[model samples]
Target: MQQTADRFPLSPRLFSFNYGRDSSAQTGCSVLDAAFKRYFSILFPEFTKDEFFDAWSEPKSFVVTVSVKSRGCDGYPDEDSDESYNLGVGDGQAVLRSVSVWGALRGLESLSQLVYQDDYGSYFINKTEIVDFPRFAYRGLLLDSSRHYLPLHAILKTLGAFHPFTHIYTQSDVKRVIEHARMRGIRVVPEFDSPGHTQSWGRGSVPSGTFGPLDPTVDSTYQFMERLLKEVKIVFPDSYLHLGGDEVSFSCWQSNPNVRKFMEKMGFGKDFTKLESFYMESIMNLTAALNRTSIVWQDVFDYHERPRSRYVVEVWKQGCYLCEMRRVTKAGLKVVLAAPFYLDLPIPTHSWARYYNVRPLAFLVLEIWKSEHYQTELSKMTKAGHRVLLSAPWYINHISYGQDWRNSYAVQPQNFSGTEEQKKLVIGGEVAMWGEYVDATNLTPRLWPRACAAAERLWSNEQLTLNADLAFPRLKEFRCELLRRGIQAEPLFVGHCKHEYDGL
Candidate 1:
């Protein structure tokens, strides 16, 4: 991003939007059209009826032109899709161009961020040129709907603020959530945690007499999983699915006579890990048959000797996270790191610096998660040739007084000890908001400005966004922008926005 000394005044009553030939053809696209209108309203929220009529009637007005190279848009964004964009704001007009519609959406977001209102109530923009792209392809947020049911409108508002991967519980409104996500160029990867979180599945999914984790020894278990996953594949068009293989309490399986009998017959005695392996492998094969990849918790790789390479491992345990990362990547499996960024654990105010200071690959040779031998670990993983997603920085559900967003903004995925090539393997990061204590009532205020910080870190260049101090005013303004858009974002400090929220 480059900025010059030049400034241009903008008038809400005399501003118009235009599209290039390719993008003009996309005007009929509901996603693009709706987004444009949404941003327009956000930019001019208080415009009167007369002002709107004057702006619509004006022939000579400042115009922003959007162009995309792709003729048609995809139903959903995928891993290989391009989200890079070039935005230029200068002269009499602004031009936004991208290779795909997804990039155009990002560019439009940047454009909206650039516009500001002055003390005199006049709109203005600085002369700026931004060539922006996500460092990682899969920047996302993970919301857990299992512990507590989140309302549909709250979920929609969340999607409006950030791209997310929803961990669906039994009560989620799946189809409506997916439809809303699709229109915003966001992919909804549904997580159906099984074999452990199956407490929710016991009512109708399993035999009435039995209730708990699916019995690995029974054919009925696999049958139920097949039917459930089949429906999931149809409902979620995304190519990836999260088959949670975490926190299995073996007591339930141990207590079952059938499971014990099957284990002994298979020459496996008291090895609960083996039972878990069997369950996960069957599910993975089922997912493959459905032509979708599976993502599981790190336990799948930790307990098994030869887990399949096609699946992704999410490392969320606190102790020895780097060791887990090395083990998973060395085995030629991709990983998503969720070890350090657990938002559910509350900390002191201004603790965001600790969150921000965590580099994905840096260590001090300590006994804890960060190790001094980071380079050696990174070199080995680079040879293995796989990318990793990070979920280590932003966990908004854990509340604190004062500005906690700075902590979220401080985390840099590539800030660790490694070569440029090794750093490139750090694909992207996600901010998780688990549902243990959070629900529809507090979801929006809890996630907004904090998650917004993570969003910028993932989307913008790290070098350009390293300074937290520089970002203060900008984020303060963005908080106001979100409020005007009806997000109900919490205040940053003991201050107020120029336009107060009316709680509509």
Candidate 2:
């Protein structure tokens, strides 16, 4: 990206838009068209149709031309969709080009960020050129809606903050949120989280005498899972399904007479880890048969012997995260690191710096990786040649006073002692907002601006985004921008946006 000191003045009334032939066809999709108009209104909310037409009579009018290589927009974003875009702003015109409609949408967002209002109520953008692409293909946010129900509108509002694949663990109208998310270049991956978190699953629906952990001893259990997962595969079009195999208590299985009988007959004497392995293997095989890949909690990988490479393990436990990463990647499986990023933990106030300094591939000492304990187990996995996703440092639900976003902005996924080829294994990361303390009311403010930090970290060049000090001013501006978009983003400092108003 190249930026100039020159500020190109833009009149909200006179600014116009043009679409290249392919882009016009792509935006013809209702969702892309709505997104385009939404961005236009966001850029100039005060302008009316008449005002825009009347200002055309004025001399200098800025026009933005959008070009897309893809002929039409896809119904939803997939892992393979290209999100790279080239944006050029200057010469009375701005050109935004992308290989797909997803990239075009991202370019539109960058364009919106460039345009800002002056103290005199006029808008201007600096002359700049940006060839931007996401560093990782699967940038996401894990929203655990199971703990606290999130309304559809709240979910949609969260989607508006970034281009992400929302990992939703809710029973609430999944199809509705999926459709709405698709409109904004977002994919919704639903997680059922069984064998442990199944407490909620069997509430009133299970047979009166039988309940908890899906009853691995019963043939009906496998049948039930098959039917449930088949429905999940049909409802969610994404390639991966999260079958949460975390925190499974053996007492539930041990207490049941039928399970005890089955275990003894199978020579699995009191070994509940084996029992969990049995359950997870059956479910995973069921998932594969339905033609969907599985993402299980790290426990499954640890307990089971070499889960198939198709399964993605999410490491969320508190100890030895680097060990878990190395173990998983060594087995030729992908891993998503979530140990250091659990937002629901009751961390003390002003701990964002601790979260910021967390390097995914670093060793841990008392839950914090010391600078000296860096280049051992963590660096070894990078050379393993398997994809890894880092979920540390972007736990947006963990709030802190002052400029906590600076801490979040400081986290770099590849900020470890590894070669470039090894670093490439670090695919992407997610900002986890587990729904324990968060609800619809505070969701937007809690997530935004903070999540924006992770969003940039995942999208922009690592070096360009490394300096939190340099990012402060731009983030402050972005926080205000979210406010203007009615996002209710929390303020960065004890100050006011020049154009900020009440009820926005």
Candidate 3:
């Protein structure tokens, strides 16, 4: 049988040529059993719920066996850890096994994606044996809820479509997003930006004629953050929490009387960046005490007296990516690359290709190649043995009205040049859909299909990316599959393909 599995984000780690007719036998996973039923029922609504259930409840159905290595596998699945699984399909039976139920959950989703209907409407699965694990532990998408509050339903939809995504602000919304994401093996890391990006937080709290940054000098500021984080920590159980530490305009800190006094008392002496560092360190310490690891933007590492390895720094500085990366990694800090992956920036066409070509470690290597002097120091600093997460082909914000912009579906995240050792430093990448102009209603279409490109890049083999001729067609089919499954992913270019394997 010609393999349809090749069309997925990350094709199964292994598979054979054998194939079997797809059966509605009860899936091993109860969660996915319901999901499959809902999926097919929506597509083939002519069948009643009983009819659908009967089809799934038949003998020799899919077998889901989870081998839990730890406690609490049944509750909310944690995305901060491993999500690997082994799947075997052949010999008249399909077996899915994982160390944790979380892996089983991901396996079920992969199985569902593998099933495609023929023109005659029969579903089939390719026989395969596979072991799969994410390259980077942190494959994520960041939605800026602080910029535009995504409706609760929209956030849930995005979570459903994008398995692991975060960056949230609204208290009530974060609770709901976390609950839904947990069910789907997605971790919702709530980012209530502190000391900066607090325009919205400052609306009702601060007095007139003042800027939005939280006042580090005031004891009340710490109290407010303590209360907020206490509430947040309870709602979000993910180990990594993002406390945005980017872009705190010093004028605001300088102007505040209490802040100035506090800085002077601490002997900071006219350096607001020091005050920024103090604020971040305080919050990091707080979250650490609360049993949560803090993730801050790269700026915090620069201002602080000494970098702490405990915090995960997301490097997003424009024009200083390599410099910042080297600094953070040399400090022994784990880093995620958000600079090259900003999806909000507008690139003319083939945007996915642009994202795919970026390599996290190549920057320093190229610099070293260009200059003979810094090779030794650059090598040591660049390869700090840290895993990197990428965010690319950011959201375009506006829908493409008529044209399916070329290259939207060409995302290949592994496009980079480096020695094998240096390249191995990459773990995975994320597709960011910042909510500056997005909401629950429109965010799905904006993210889908295009984000699928990043998904495939992060999951699939790099060899597949080399041949766009093959990757493009597979990606088109993947997008349609997502749409058929009720995800609102937009088309690659212009008109939609009507069938599951159209234009292939």
Candidate 4:
């Protein structure tokens, strides 16, 4: 018989059998055994810690043995490392083996889904074999803390829900998160969105009265940025930092006399657009000085005469996504897609279907392109080389009465009609839980099983998306499982775990 609950992002390959009896989770490594004990304790909070330890240590009818090639924590997810694992169960014992600790962590998560509580309250797993690995290297979730700061505890809770990377804020919070992420094999990337998105910044700095985008004309602006980047480098060791450069209102700079004077001095004309570009180029230089890659919104293309190929531009404008993709790739730059992925929009109904229809690489060059030149550029992006990250279920905090769209399990990132080569250009997608309407109390449920939808889409094969009936039940179970482990991720339909696990 097939596995009773085949989950979403269904394994690249899986086979099932009817095991006559249940089995225990077994591991020879003390560290691995302790980890499973902790996991089981969370899943069965009604049981004492000692009971979990004994159960994990002793073999029952259903046994799972996990063996990793290496046994050290990686402090960060090795995006390029092999995250593939093989799980096999026969004759009452199951084996989970991976070449890396990261893969082992993934396998453990999969195994947890395989085992579930029956109506009689006993836990069991049908005999199964699963070999799995993620299709994309960078499966991330971009949470904006600048708009509305997320507290440390809330941040930790969000981390537990399987976001591989998030744009972190607060210098003091970095060490706490880094320590936690290391144990979970998640990496924390920081975004100090400079030049623009600085309205929240500059409380104690020069250009005293000015607010909003950084005054690009001020010499002190660069000094302030350098100081901030210096602090950010010390806190976040991730390879990339986002220097936000989108939706900048140049009216502030255009009206400021001092800014105009500085712009003229720097050889830029009176146009504030050039100042925006100049600021981005200078910030990219600063990021390089700190030995880090810079990520920015695509608007930098509007003013920057020649954007560096190394910077990763996040394409966020919905109306002109294809145009931006062509421009970025034609200039030999990388891009991440956030247009169709904005999760903040209000979806009072059928939200899952909306997110499910998003195809990251399905843009029609002939229709979106204004000219033959634009078409040629699009072709170049497809053939030459380009990769993008998709954020389908964008701002998760916004919800209506009844079912919250944020919890929908329909974020199909690969719903494109492109050829296989074109589809390959999609690096992965994110759950952009922008904080404009989110905070401590609401962030977890806002992102939970909803973000996991994106997670499975990024990690699992494309085949699962073809059939929603097959994926939804597993998604519901996954959400309940998360609840079982003390995650207050709100319910999708309307039911509670038979045994509630309380208090994160």
Candidate 5:
């Protein structure tokens, strides 16, 4: 059977739930499940509710065996396992396994393609036999509650909305997303972006007017984070909790002398990085005490900010220099490289070539060969080992460009500036929707086709060509499927249409 799918142009299109009482969680992610079932029912009359929850099917049905292993299996499980395949669907000769939420999302996309075959033209999961599994065992997403607060209702809404996917934001959303993600053998990694990002709820202000002040050293801040993180662990049972350690201007400390005084009393000298280390160490200790590891931004390592090895660095800087990537890996810690994966950049001129070219490590392909230097320091880190993460921002804040992020977001990965090897380095891609401008009307349309493109890159992701302009027909079919499923996608871009868009 043909494994590599016919590479279609990225037709990005990509969920939600509940009744009056909110039945979206355990019971089919009630809201989104209802929508999914209803939508699929319209398409396939035989798709019943029981079949959706059957959990286990046979090789004939194309079993998706998902296994959880401790160390790297070179992206495969035990040798005795069922047939093996990448995220792209092939024959039942092997199943695709991935622990990443992004991985599971990819799996879902593959299964979705199989289930919704007619929608995508002459496509079908012809014949296959296999089981799928994940290597590292923890695939996740981190939401910065510190920057902007997400209320309880929104948290539940996220559970419902992302029901079909492996992503859930808050600790509160874990138990819920887990019920589904875990059923598919995917892990739910929740993040608490504290310290600097927490101004939205605690310190109350940031900069002069952006939000307000955020005293990273505030005792109350620690108390709140401690309780929240602990509560989250309980909800998740067994999952990593992300402690966001990024983008703090340090003005919060400069403004508050008490924060400085607190640091000084702790025996840490008056160094900023040192203080940041202390702050992170404290949170790290708290999480460790609960037997949970933390996900922190890599900048914390900029000046010897030693956060225990339990804390993983999620690199987010713009450049993809080899020296920089090696530095974090050499520190004897796990790494998830997200720097070259910024999909939110509104500027298309940065070019995919630029993104694809950033290897941040040596011995890469010519496509990634650039004038940028690759140092031994990073090579050593590469030898020590690391985990690469790809993050695509679905961040549509209020100020985010209207309707434009669509053109750029979906194909960012394919449009990348590097070699094929570098592209494969991406374990998976995330549709990070930063809740800013998304209120109601445009959120659905703004995110659908674009996020689906991200999914396409991760799933059935062979021979990718981010020809957004060329994807209209396939996108229209995908959009029609989503519409059949109840998601409100943007109108098909039939230019010279019989109507006009609002003169915005």
Candidate 6:
């Protein structure tokens, strides 16, 4: 039984799963584990995963093995896996308890949400008893390093930063972010952007003038990325990788007439968009060969001039809504919203409220493949049945000098205009740390306890309000709480935006 929000439910039982059959991860794919444990202790102030698992995973018991898939409270059975979840059975009736790859990972993330201590997010589990999988074969989060050129450490830090806020990846920290997600069951997709957003990915801090193609055409670049991806993939094995492909400054191609000529010789004509599609197809093939999905940003739409059903276009800005997602959705492509959740663009109180309300599909469409229609894009998507996910960017560039960029989370709940029940529809949010001004040295501080606020808002119940008056005082306790957990947040300031917002 799920506790209904971010709170972990007291389950008398706990089960287990493996990576396609490997052992459970003990440590270090993300800082997420620490984030979860820290928050769990604060909320519950007691109880441990060890204690719960000890009782839940007990060997011999009556359990329900499923032969059919349970329908949504509608009682219609669907197909499912007979995979066992280990609920210790006592009487003829079985107490639903068990963990699979999806459930366990999500629980790890949910624990980080920390809405309530005792109910650390277990209620989300619904044992349907059938094998489930993602509808879209490919799902991913593309972290742009080209723009800010973040290091390996930053990438790891990003995964850690997003842990609690997203069920995209989890493994204890003691609860799961994906619990609610996995209960409904979704895939955990992660991405590492390079080349285009790679102005920052080159050697030393990318010099201002040194931006160009991420060397999708270079072998050396592949070698560098190969080692990086191999290491990070274990932390996120949902089998998708987002190769960021939006707004790539075509300077490299434009500067080198030979590069343009090369495209024309290759039958792509003289269009730079064709050149971009060449890059997309090339990467997709490489990733697909590795058994992963080629998730990219939206520029690929114009790049390929093909209806890419397999591609996942994560919309980064307003241009995406106007250009990509709307057209792509109409063309039968899957997508995710990254607009409203731009965590970097900090606007004190309800700034996120607008973002939270920024729906992924277009409320009205202007054109698609030469057709015109005023259609709700998201409805079309859900109707055509394409997969979707939520992305909230908390990159440092948009953050202020001393403001707890992490504290920006304090704004998320205010972002949602719904009842506790409706908040559940918010699959979850991601705390993205785009690497423009941040590096390993200053990264962690830029993303701590305050970031935890966003984490909590994403996974926890909507019970918390977005009142600065109430939160300002609590922010002190929370910041200290994070420091205690080894994360330091900037000191809290009440209505510091008064000078700015009050004037507005």
Candidate that scores best on TM-score: 1
Descending-lDDT candidate ranking: 1, 2, 4, 3, 5, 6
| Candidate 6 lDDT over residue span 282-360, tens digit each | 6666676666666565445445545344655443443223233334444444555443344454456533223222322
Q: For model 4, what is the C-alpha lDDT against the true structure?
A: 0.58
Whole-model alpha-carbon lDDT for candidate 3: 0.55
Q: What are the per-model C-alpha RMSD values against the true structure?
A: 4.3, 4.7, 7.4, 7.0, 10.6, 12.1
Better of 1 and 2 by TM-score: 1
| Candidate 2 segments whose C-alpha is farther than 4 A from its true place | 22-27, 50-59, 160-172, 204-211, 319-323, 344-346, 358-387, 415-423
Instruction: Spell out the clash pairs found in candidate 1.
Output: 136-427, 352-407, 356-410, 356-411, 365-372
Mind sharing the TM-score for model 6?
A: 0.52
lDDT of each: 0.69, 0.68, 0.55, 0.58, 0.43, 0.40
50-151 in candidate 2: lDDT tens per residue? Answer: 654332234478998888877556468887789899999996899999988788888888898888766666678899999988877877789877667676
Q: What is the C-alpha RMSD, rounded to one decimal, of candidate 3? A: 7.4
Candidate 3 Cα errors over 4 Å, as ranges: 1-46, 49-71, 160-174, 204-209, 319-324, 360-428, 461-469, 499-504
Error of 5 at 458 (Å): 3.9
Model 5 residue 503 CA deviation (Å) reads 20
Task: Rate residue 227 of model 1 by lDDT.
Answer: 94
RMSD of 1: 4.3
Top-lDDT candidate index: 1
Query: Which of candidates 2 and 6 reaches a greater TM-score?
Result: 2
What's each prediction's TM-score? 0.88, 0.87, 0.77, 0.80, 0.58, 0.52
- Tens-place lDDT per residue, model 4, 1-504, is 134343222111121212112222223443344456655554445554344233233334444566676545433564466788888755566678887667776777777667655555444566677888886767777776666656667777777222224533445567778767755667777777766667655643345775677777668779988998998888777877877777788777888888888888888877777778888888889999998877766566545636554565455554434444454455444445554455555666745544444343555543444222222222233333444443323445445544443233344433333445544554555567787787666777777766666566567766655444566676778888787777887676667666455776
For candidate 6, give the lDDT of residue 50. Answer: 65
lDDT: which is higher, 3 or 4?
4
